[model samples]
Target chain A: MSTPENWTPQERQLHDALHRSAERVQPGPDGLARIRRRTAVVPMWRRPVVLGLAGATALAAAVIVGGVIALNDGDDDAPVASQTSTSPAPSPSDTTAQTAPPTTPPAETTPPAQSLTVPVYYVADSGDGLRLVREFHAIETSLTPIAAAVNEMLTAPPADPDYRSLWAPGVEVTAADLADGAIVVDLSAPPTAGEDPDLAAQQLVYTATAAAASAGQDGSLPVRITVGGQDPSEPIGRTDPLEVRQLVQLNDPAEGATLPSPVTVTGEAAVYEANVLWELRRDGEVVDSGNTTAEECCTFSPFSLELDLEPGAYQIVVSESDESGGEGRPPMSDSRTFTVE
Target chain B: MVQDRTGSEADDAITDLYAAHYVRLVRLATLLLGNEAVAEEVVQDAFVALHSRWRRLREPAAAVAYLRTSVVHGSRSVQRRRGVAARHPDEPPGHAPSAEQVAVGGAAADAVVEALRGLPHRQREALVLRYYGGLSEAEIASAMKISNGAVKSHASRGLAGLREAMADWS
Candidate 1:
């Protein structure tokens, strides 16, 4: 289709000759079978199958909507995992917290005694705008989740091929500490090198807030970022201004966590009108699907749904529909696969 | 609910894709990677990833394009993992040229390959996808995740460089 106007007859002859030559190379005889055998069992933990496989355990996980909370100190008094007609299945370990006082707010009052995989946000340039990409980074419980996540951000590049980072070379999050109920982040250098300064700033803010939320930090804290100790008032493109919990995040069914039918999906999302769409698929076919509303919208708030399916390998995907209600762009979404027993 | 992927319609589709495109993709990969074994591995991985994400693929018709893109990226990652030069110390037996290799059979083919290999990765990819893969500029751009203009730029520069190198070889 790309014929060159200035092409020499000899060059055209060479192109034809090269094309004919490359066509002769062949793969080995068993190449097809080998590829099929290798790819036969695509693990359920892949991107589409966000939830891990469900086993025979049949533990119903109750979706804890509203806010992501830190695991309580009294392991002995953890709420008992339970099954209610309408409640989402609860993981075995989370059963003890079933009786947790709903009124109490979670705080970073105590250091985590357990490890957590904190979701760090990075920017994916979509040509039109920058979309936030999330990747879970594992941190030792000994390290504060927020601080550790920022440190990880400095060295870790986005694993997704479509996404990249704007963090300039040698850009370091010098300090990340909670004071006056806000997470103050000190950066060695600004991410001004990127195409958009606002997106670069949001990348840091979203990642920091999500990290804090994942660690069970009180979601009330706002991320206040300072470059070289100077505050950039009203950091551009601030999404969640009200509370830290405004981060649209999945708090339950931790990545790769197994679950049972009537599985409850819970996460924080900031949608146009608190609406989130959920679909359940087993073996790539939709089995059950619907929409659920979060507590509120225009900010990250908790939402929950209970899905019942016959025992099988299933992936649950949750997405926020675009406001126009037209399928213009890919909806912001998250998914996980879990086996239903 | 057990979503049975093995031996199901999805598996059948994968098998069909494997049968239809496996060799061509292998050739494509080999052209990009300059090695047979790694090309095989990269194509296999692409299929596996495709199978895993099959459900998310909005259009089943785009599977070929999807496979092409995945193979391209997979080959890039392999090259990256292997460092600047993907030197395979464990080169399998048969360093000897195949009958097919003998058939194409000349210093010109070798010179073309050498010239193609010497170009920058983007330029080489643009040319291979264009001439060898027989992709349109738009298709090449989609496969490489770049703009059409970029695709045209890379291909033109690549072809010019290849011609220059071939002239020197003569």
Candidate 2:
């Protein structure tokens, strides 16, 4: 490479401009801390069994992977109806099953079913276009994780008003099972193709795959969609996140979570220079505003922020910085209303 | 005593390398990836990977080379995924001047960055490594996993492309 002394004026200008463009990029103070934390965690490949149960915490930790550890002997067909009765009370036999040793036979132990959190994908309008977003919902079910997640994706209204399912209401999962390394989902009726047919199919594809992954199955499995007794369509697989997902997403302090002080906000975003901006609001009034950078820019990567706040209901909205300098479309954002006590 | 000394030596090497090169490596990655957060992650991952294989890479110079190559490879993987995601036929042109650019009033620099973002991945990588990273042709070639001749061609083509893209600025 030619030295700076040998550079032509044009080359010098280019060099100067490049340096100036990145001059403002002073990385956050937590880089070393973050790297240490990641290094400390045993890589998933080294601990495959623990990988399946990785994010299961508190209430969801009791959820048995694969859903084969039948917690309830109740009729599997009436999962919703049985939910109310089984939640508040564990039968005498269920208590015995819970205390049984690991050596006990599978046929003898029947523990009570517990609520588990499953990720459900929903469609939302990201200023530029419609894309998929996800929310974790705690559901009490005796059915497999894939079945419960698909059922919720079909039936439940998203907690966030900005998000909605493209799947028509009243549609239910007839069956959801892993077969031949792909998830096969059977629906009660064929879903009407929305404005975007591929994205519409992707809603279920993302949901089923996410549910499968959470339940310890391969998350990358293509989803085979069968409507009624009809033949299945070409298997739907996950599209690149940048194309199908909102550019900004908030993954922590889930919608309406109540927790203590020093709340940690984290999510993934693909924004210019990885600049993620945020605003905290209480009763629709802005209380705090700031910015954080994601791990990388122009593609979805993780970003996190910590906030210490007094007791109150707050809405934290995170967005991409307006790279257009106020000329292009509004920056995409995701927000959640949470409380701190 | 020998095991303890080796362990402490390893820790010292990592600490010294981190202090000396962490920020610089992150900046290099940010220039390549156009996302500071991802760049930091890429560099951090490089450090973590280097730590695991530190015994094999005892020399500081060799460790630094390992980091640069890892960052380059990591950035390439990220760009490949992004390329697939951004393959939409109707996607718009390159990035516009950001809010910070407007605030700082560095329209000229912003224009150059925007033009750079529009270049092909290899060409951009080559140019960033040469002009901004100040790496020699051989170093660039090693980091990018390409031949020295390829690096020269990519840098020349990238410079020409940037000039054309930023023609309005000049």
Candidate 3:
């Protein structure tokens, strides 16, 4: 493969350039730890040893299976129907034992319907400009996922104080459904298109599509907006995320999670040279500060860093470095507060 | 050969693969997705997936291939969901290329990377897996789930686009 005779100068140049560009990307040190945490949570049936153990003791297997089902039903009952249907009877003798435990508790504990974790989008002012930020809200309603999410986007106050809905208050989603590979959303009133009309429209598009996806519908479909029985215009589709999303967003260690040692911070950013700077603060005082680079420069890429610290409440603020030396708009930033126990 | 492998053995194999390929795979995904955070998540998900299916795929060679295929497919899903926004169309007007260009190995490299981002998804995947990943035509074909002939066509067409994009550099 290294034979020089077959290589063109352009290809060689590209190879060198690609390596130089890619060499800057360093995976976080906590990657294995993160993967281990995830793998540990995978269903026991997927592991051979666990399956072997389950095969040996039918009663024990039934109990374990029932326990897993009970736990899952507690969190979300919508998927349990399909799960029980597929794994109808792991053991013929214990079928009654297993099925009886899972079926009863849900009916007693849960209400008539299950609530969905809907991804709701809101507009936020960042150093870069106004951009869309997302928050997941557990919405309990009879409305479909699309309508429920759109309704929340219009009515609910953003959990984050800095974020807000672009749609006017009292606006409600009259109906929402997927048809012909497009999401059709009808609003009770014509929305007040804010200064950035495109972004305002995107707020609806992102929210509707995100909610639909949560319900197992295609998220990429364009959204057709109808207001007061009138079509606003052509259906609105997603804009390039880099252009529309805040330059820096802190995704993990969500706003106020309490964690053990070695807390890992992960987020996305599009900054000059892909550099993201972070400051760890407590009691409104800067405690620790450091900088890390994202995978790519001048484009949105992921960056992660891990910190080991003593237990207490702390805030981590991550931002882009000012490449313009204070000339351009201030480097965009995002932050979250969490307790380290 | 499909024995019930112990957890520690699986952990050791995963650790070895992680040490060897995690950074490179993440970089490959970053190139494909242009977002490192999402790229890392994609690669990490691939690893977790590999760990779950380890008994079925016990060989290191097969594992590496699985990781590559997983990363490729993962990146494709992200791109599909995010919807292809034209690259850098929103670079604030009057904003000059930052001084970081020198740090990334000069403007020519930056131009190449930028131009590479503009190509069609298949062509970009072909070129990246070929030149950057140093995979053979057959490997690229398998990773991309396309034919060797298709890989060749995408690579040639992608190179043409890069050459045209970087014409000033030449």
Q: Which candidate should be chosen as best, given DockQ against the real structure?
A: 3
Ranked candidates (DockQ, high to low): 3, 2, 1
lDDT minimum window of 10 residues, candidate 3 chain A: A101-110
Off by over 4 Å in 2: A1-112, B1-170
In model 3, the Cα lDDT at residue B25 comes to 97
Please report the candidate that would top TM-score against the real structure. Answer: 2
Cα lDDT tens digits, model 1, B42-160, are 88888878877777773666989999999999888886676223324333222355676656544466667767778898998898787678788889999999999999899878878
Each prediction's total of clashing residue pairs, residues at least 3 apart in sequence or on different chains, is: 34, 7, 5
> Lowest lDDT 10-mer window, candidate 2 chain B?
B85-94
lDDT of 3 by residue, A172-269 (tens): 87666554345667677777655678888999988998887777766766676765434434556676555576767777776667899799999887
TM-score head-to-head 1 vs 3, winner: 1
Q: CA shift at A289, candidate 3, in angstroms?
A: 1.7
1 against 3, candidate with superior DockQ:
3
Better of 2 and 3 by TM-score: 2
lDDT of 2 at A272: 71
lDDT of 3 at A53: 25
